[model samples]
Target: MDRITLAFWSLVIGLCGATAFFVTGIYGQQATQQQREAKLESGDLVQLVKVIDGDTVVVSKEGQPNATVRLLGIKTLESKHGKDEVAVYGRAAEEALKRLVGDKPLRVLLNTPPRDRHGRTIATLYAGDQDIGLGLISQGHALVYSVYPFASMPVYLQAQTTARANNLGLWGDPEVSAKAEAMINEWARQGS
Candidate 1:
């Protein structure tokens, strides 16, 4: 075969390989989305395995596999999210959450889409009707995370207000609390 023909065929093969890779990636994303939706629809109660951070936890329920649950309507200081940024009261917030919600099967309440962009459950957790997010906010470990659409925004905001009023947990640390308040304000603005 001519060199020119050989080169053309090689280029065609490369294009085909690239297209296949792109197509596969798209399907993988779709399958992930479908899996998340199915999990949310299941409504299986999950036992808390451990806390990943202040606002995230690992849980497992019957029938379904273990999954990471991101606590809704609250954003706590980042404790272990790499070296880019770290907050002062991050560990304290995690410890407080562990204490507040010991060992229990948290009923996952799907408020909106089953998962966030990162593929984690975006839902409210309840320990026998008690909202977990409210408990965390009341202790001042987390601020009302109103940057996104959520049903518990008003209640979470109220809990945060009460925490601030009495100077509970992180609220006692003025510097940290001030930074958190600034973040909360920004989240509220974006949400609006």
Candidate 2:
């Protein structure tokens, strides 16, 4: 074969190999994304294994390991390692979540990208028709997590406004509200 023809064929083969690599990579990424979406489909029923706090819980899906789920669009006071007033409100939040969830199976709805920086799955859990995250905000046990963008942000904010207006739960107590506000600001600062 002529040197020119041999060089042309070699170049064509290299280009074909590169194209195949890129195409495979794109398809592989799509497959991975699809798997993630399918892993926690909306309306998947899960048992509430434990309430970590007002905004977090341990849940068990059928045939899957227990997962730590952080409620989307809400932040609860620290239930551990805080002063008396903060801890008081924090525990109140936990109890409120427990009461809301009871022993019922939760309908899990995941947020885009699903996982948080801490590797916990970020989800909005529902007990029947009630959104557990919104319920906490409505009861003033949680603050609307405005730091992160989520689909329920607007509704969560509205619930929090009503809770504040009614002086329900944490908002009813001036001391707790002040402490929670300070903590939330600090959290925002850390996140930024």
Best by lDDT: 2
Residue 51's lDDT within candidate 1 is 91
Task: Please give the range of 10 consecutive residues that has the lowest summed lDDT in model 2.
Answer: 30-39
Error of 2 at 44 (Å): 0.9
Top of the candidates by TM-score: 1
Per-residue lDDT tens digits for candidate 2, residues 95-190, read 999999999999999888888766678899999999999999999999987777778888988888899899998899998888767866876786
- List the candidate 1 regions with Cα displacement exceeding 4 Å: 1-38, 81-88
Collision count for each candidate, in order: 0, 0
lDDT scores in order: 0.79, 0.85
TM-score for every candidate vs. truth?
0.76, 0.74
lDDT of 1 by residue, 3-37 (tens): 99999999999999999999999979967754753
